[model samples]
Target: MLKLLSTTLLLSSFIYANNVSEKVEDFLDDKFMENPRLKSVDVTVSDVVPLKQLAGWNAYIVDVEAYLKAQPKRLIKQRMIWFSDGRIITKELTDMQGGESLTDLVKPPFKDEYYKKENLLFGNPDAKHKVAIFSDPLCPFCKGFVPGALDYMKKDPKKFAVYYYHFPLERLHPASVHLVKAAAAAELQGDKNVIEKLYHVQINPQERDVKKILKAFNKAVGTKLTPKDLNTPAVIKQVNRDLDIANAVMVGGTPTIYLDGKVDNTKKKYLKVQ
Candidate 1:
């Protein structure tokens, strides 16, 4: 009787795994891979594990491995949900408590020390509401968003704190590296408006004219920053640290904001012009 039970359990597990894998593959082929080249690529989905039931949903974690016919392969870890109403949601999940989202309990997709003192940009250091922004100085969206966030915190100093990190898109904006380093140096110098100055100066990132941009940076922020000031160990280290954090968080573009450690889905809540 024990041997027969073991055989039946193993078969059941195998069938369950196969069915989930097929479903995921079909979902990806139909909805995810939009590019023709990507659709043609081979995909392998495995390691489907049901995590837990929360509220009215069941959480499942899966590892998807994809291989291009003649290119490099990649692996992506995904969190999927199975709703009680026969709906499957991919990407993020959340829980509610007391008629509000329990954002503090939500496990962040990435582990980052964003609230460190060194990363703080503006507002009261002890404010309970923490906002972290990973942004590129040359990104048009960031020019308005980063400074706007700082301004918002300035209004409610007791309620919010802001941490800003540099993520220079060197491929698109070659001069961004220098500007980011300058921002780091300015932060070191206790210049509170480093981000605002950088956005206001409006130097073309593609120009790559370090001296011209440095001159503009100095004029905008009231700092006599030479090229040497940007290359100091502390400045470069801070910039590299920002880059490391951005990469770890998988930030795809500028002005990615996290409100209290979770990605803020509603921009209007935090970013609306006041």
Candidate 2:
């Protein structure tokens, strides 16, 4: 391997003896034009060429390693990234911010109250920050917001208050209604910590004994209620409120979230994932 590399280097040196820089550029240009492997490389280059002019997009932050390696001086926020070295790597961009906008948040014209008043549901009443989450009980997308979301909150609990609501696509999964109802009922038991656990952890409806969920709910979050307590009228009322809010918000699917009401349909704000 070492001898082959040495021979290639010697041959390249001989080929480029007089016009080294020109020869190198011509070689690369020819490779760029003719090689299919280089064609794939061109795609990466075209995707990022906008960066040269700083005509940005929301996808520049993806493939942090490739972006960093390809353009050591650049800072990208969204989109794909790639380059050839001795290794290969890539990533899909998330968390879009608009082009040429230095601020992480985009300005929306309406007051947050507009979205909140329409969609807000089960959460701590006195909580400072509000997040409305639309989730199907049985959907994997909804389940993605689990322990990861909790960890995100732990960073700054005071700034993150999540409102859980069910947008169960019951026609698709008949079992979703029961799970949504149980989850809503769990919320009223006054321990969001436990409710979130049950929301995130207990997903399987078949093996899901109501007692197991209630047990995990109890053990993880120390709620002040028996399973029967969730059957009360007040709990029923709370569950109804959650469903009503989910309906009002036009929650189409599970795991849809409005962040502080700033990211929603009243405005055309594209959601940035965590």
Best candidate (score: TM-score): 1
Worst 10 residues of 2 by lDDT: 58-67
> Each model's RMSD to truth, in Å?
7.9, 18.8
Model 2: lDDT equals 0.46
Give lDDT per model, in order.
0.67, 0.46
Tens-digit lDDT track for model 1 on 1-274? 9999999999996786566666666675565466544424334453343434354343333333444444545433332232221246455444434343332233235444556678877678778677888888888888767777677677886677778888888899888888888888988998877777788776777878889989878887788889999999999788877766765555667778887766764544565423
Taking the tens digit of each residue's C-alpha lDDT, what string does model 2 give over 98-157? 343222232222234433432334344455666666666567655665445645654554
TM-score of each: 0.61, 0.43
Q: How far is candidate 1 from the true structure (C-alpha RMSD, Å)?
A: 7.9
**How well does candidate 2 match the true structure in TM-score terms?**
0.43
What's the CA error at residue 210 for candidate 2, in Å? 6.0
Runs in model 2 with CA error above 4 Å? 1-129, 200-203, 206-230, 262-274
Pick out the ten consecutive residues of candidate 1 with the lowest summed lDDT: 77-86
lDDT accuracy of residue 68 in candidate 1: 46
Off by over 4 Å in 1: 1-112, 271-274
